[model samples]
Target: MVNIALGASLSTVILTVPVMEAISLYTGQPFIMAMTSVQTVMVTITLIVAAINLNDGQTNAIEGMTHFVLFATFVMLTVLGL
Candidate 1:
Protein backbone atom coordinates (compact mmCIF):
# COMPACT_ATOMS: atom_id res chain seq x y z
CA MET A 1 0.00 0.00 0.00
CA VAL A 2 2.80 2.37 0.85
CA ASN A 3 4.53 1.59 -2.39
CA ILE A 4 1.32 2.21 -4.29
CA ALA A 5 0.82 5.50 -2.52
CA LEU A 6 4.37 6.58 -3.23
CA GLY A 7 4.08 5.61 -6.87
CA ALA A 8 0.81 7.46 -7.23
CA SER A 9 2.24 10.57 -5.63
CA LEU A 10 5.23 10.55 -7.93
CA SER A 11 3.08 9.85 -10.96
CA THR A 12 0.84 12.76 -10.15
CA VAL A 13 3.78 15.13 -10.08
CA ILE A 14 5.28 13.72 -13.23
CA LEU A 15 2.01 13.84 -15.13
CA THR A 16 0.85 17.19 -13.89
CA VAL A 17 3.93 19.17 -14.82
CA PRO A 18 3.64 18.94 -18.59
CA VAL A 19 -0.11 19.44 -18.52
CA MET A 20 0.35 22.51 -16.42
CA GLU A 21 3.06 23.77 -18.70
CA ALA A 22 0.86 23.27 -21.73
CA ILE A 23 -1.98 25.11 -20.10
CA SER A 24 0.33 27.94 -19.23
CA LEU A 25 1.41 28.20 -22.87
CA TYR A 26 -2.14 28.20 -24.17
CA THR A 27 -3.19 30.85 -21.68
CA GLY A 28 -0.08 32.96 -22.23
CA GLN A 29 0.80 32.73 -18.55
CA PRO A 30 4.20 31.68 -17.39
CA PHE A 31 4.19 28.50 -15.34
CA ILE A 32 6.31 28.74 -12.27
CA MET A 33 8.19 25.47 -12.41
CA ALA A 34 10.80 26.36 -9.87
CA MET A 35 10.77 25.24 -6.29
CA THR A 36 12.02 27.38 -3.47
CA SER A 37 14.88 26.04 -1.40
CA VAL A 38 12.56 25.45 1.51
CA GLN A 39 10.12 23.59 -0.71
CA THR A 40 12.92 21.43 -2.08
CA VAL A 41 14.15 20.69 1.42
CA MET A 42 10.67 19.76 2.56
CA VAL A 43 10.24 17.38 -0.37
CA THR A 44 13.56 15.70 0.37
CA ILE A 45 12.74 15.36 4.03
CA THR A 46 9.27 14.03 3.31
CA LEU A 47 10.60 11.40 0.92
CA ILE A 48 13.31 10.35 3.36
CA VAL A 49 10.86 10.03 6.19
CA ALA A 50 8.46 8.06 4.01
CA ALA A 51 11.25 5.69 2.96
CA ILE A 52 12.26 5.14 6.56
CA ASN A 53 8.71 4.55 7.67
CA LEU A 54 8.06 2.03 4.89
CA ASN A 55 11.34 0.20 5.25
CA ASP A 56 9.81 -2.37 7.62
CA GLY A 57 6.87 -3.02 5.28
CA GLN A 58 4.45 -2.47 8.13
CA THR A 59 2.59 0.56 9.35
CA ASN A 60 0.04 1.66 11.90
CA ALA A 61 -2.04 4.68 12.82
CA ILE A 62 1.03 6.40 14.20
CA GLU A 63 2.69 6.28 10.82
CA GLY A 64 -0.38 7.67 9.16
CA MET A 65 -0.51 10.49 11.67
CA THR A 66 3.13 11.25 11.06
CA HIS A 67 2.46 11.53 7.34
CA PHE A 68 -0.50 13.80 7.98
CA VAL A 69 1.62 16.03 10.19
CA LEU A 70 4.27 16.24 7.53
CA PHE A 71 1.68 17.14 4.93
CA ALA A 72 0.32 19.81 7.20
CA THR A 73 3.82 21.13 7.62
CA PHE A 74 4.22 21.27 3.86
CA VAL A 75 0.97 23.19 3.48
CA MET A 76 1.93 25.61 6.20
CA LEU A 77 5.30 26.23 4.65
CA THR A 78 3.80 26.83 1.24
CA VAL A 79 1.21 29.23 2.59
CA LEU A 80 3.83 31.16 4.50
CA GLY A 81 6.17 31.16 1.47
CA LEU A 82 8.96 30.16 3.80
Candidate 2:
Protein backbone atom coordinates (compact mmCIF):
# COMPACT_ATOMS: atom_id res chain seq x y z
CA MET A 1 0.00 0.00 0.00
CA VAL A 2 2.81 2.36 0.86
CA ASN A 3 4.56 1.52 -2.39
CA ILE A 4 1.34 2.04 -4.32
CA ALA A 5 0.72 5.39 -2.69
CA LEU A 6 4.28 6.50 -3.29
CA GLY A 7 4.14 5.48 -6.93
CA ALA A 8 0.87 7.30 -7.48
CA SER A 9 2.14 10.42 -5.76
CA LEU A 10 5.36 10.41 -7.75
CA SER A 11 3.50 9.88 -11.00
CA THR A 12 1.41 12.99 -10.42
CA VAL A 13 4.56 15.09 -10.62
CA ILE A 14 5.88 13.11 -13.56
CA LEU A 15 2.67 13.51 -15.49
CA THR A 16 2.14 17.11 -14.49
CA VAL A 17 5.45 18.48 -15.73
CA PRO A 18 4.78 17.95 -19.39
CA VAL A 19 1.27 19.32 -19.14
CA MET A 20 2.48 22.30 -17.15
CA GLU A 21 5.24 22.90 -19.63
CA ALA A 22 2.78 22.85 -22.47
CA ILE A 23 0.54 25.29 -20.65
CA SER A 24 3.50 27.55 -19.99
CA LEU A 25 4.38 27.49 -23.68
CA TYR A 26 0.85 28.50 -24.63
CA THR A 27 0.31 30.96 -21.79
CA GLY A 28 3.81 32.42 -21.68
CA GLN A 29 3.93 31.93 -17.93
CA PRO A 30 6.52 29.59 -16.45
CA PHE A 31 5.12 27.40 -13.71
CA ILE A 32 7.75 24.69 -13.49
CA MET A 33 9.23 26.18 -10.34
CA ALA A 34 5.84 26.24 -8.62
CA MET A 35 5.18 22.67 -9.67
CA THR A 36 8.58 21.60 -8.42
CA SER A 37 8.00 23.26 -5.07
CA VAL A 38 4.61 21.58 -4.73
CA GLN A 39 6.17 18.21 -5.48
CA THR A 40 8.93 18.80 -2.94
CA VAL A 41 6.42 19.73 -0.25
CA MET A 42 4.35 16.65 -1.02
CA VAL A 43 7.37 14.38 -0.78
CA THR A 44 8.42 15.93 2.49
CA ILE A 45 4.94 15.50 3.95
CA THR A 46 4.72 11.89 2.79
CA LEU A 47 8.11 11.12 4.28
CA ILE A 48 7.13 12.62 7.60
CA VAL A 49 3.89 10.65 7.68
CA ALA A 50 5.68 7.41 6.84
CA ALA A 51 8.35 7.97 9.46
CA ILE A 52 5.86 8.73 12.19
CA ASN A 53 3.52 5.85 11.36
CA LEU A 54 6.23 3.23 10.86
CA ASN A 55 7.99 4.08 14.11
CA ASP A 56 4.81 3.28 16.05
CA GLY A 57 4.30 -0.11 14.36
CA GLN A 58 0.63 0.00 15.12
CA THR A 59 -2.50 1.24 13.41
CA ASN A 60 -6.08 1.62 14.54
CA ALA A 61 -9.42 2.47 13.01
CA ILE A 62 -8.77 6.14 13.57
CA GLU A 63 -5.49 5.86 11.79
CA GLY A 64 -7.23 4.18 8.90
CA MET A 65 -9.77 7.00 8.80
CA THR A 66 -7.01 9.55 8.97
CA HIS A 67 -5.30 7.96 6.01
CA PHE A 68 -8.49 7.89 4.05
CA VAL A 69 -9.24 11.48 4.90
CA LEU A 70 -5.76 12.57 3.94
CA PHE A 71 -5.91 10.85 0.56
CA ALA A 72 -9.41 12.08 -0.11
CA THR A 73 -8.43 15.60 0.80
CA PHE A 74 -5.44 15.40 -1.50
CA VAL A 75 -7.57 14.20 -4.40
CA MET A 76 -10.25 16.79 -3.81
CA LEU A 77 -7.73 19.57 -3.46
CA THR A 78 -6.02 18.52 -6.65
CA VAL A 79 -9.29 18.38 -8.53
CA LEU A 80 -10.53 21.65 -7.12
CA GLY A 81 -7.18 23.41 -7.42
CA LEU A 82 -7.37 24.35 -3.79
Best by TM-score: 1
Steric clashes per prediction: 0, 0
* lDDT: worst 10-residue window of model 1: 9-18
Off by over 4 Å in 2: 1-36
Candidate 2, 1-82: lDDT as tens digits:
9999989978887897788888989999866464445546665776677677768898778767766766776666667765
Q: Relative to the unseen true structure, what is the C-alpha lDDT of residue 46 in candidate 1, on a scale of 0 to 100?
A: 85
Q: Give the alpha-carbon lDDT of every model.
A: 0.90, 0.72
Which regions of candidate 1 deviate over 4 angstroms? Answer: 1-10, 13-32
Tell how far residue 34 is off in model 1, in angstroms.
1.5
Ten consecutive residues with minimal summed lDDT in candidate 2?
34-43
> What lDDT tens digits, residue by residue, belong to model 1 across residues 1-82?
9799979988888988888988999999999858999989888988898898999999889988988998999999999988
TM, every model: 0.64, 0.45
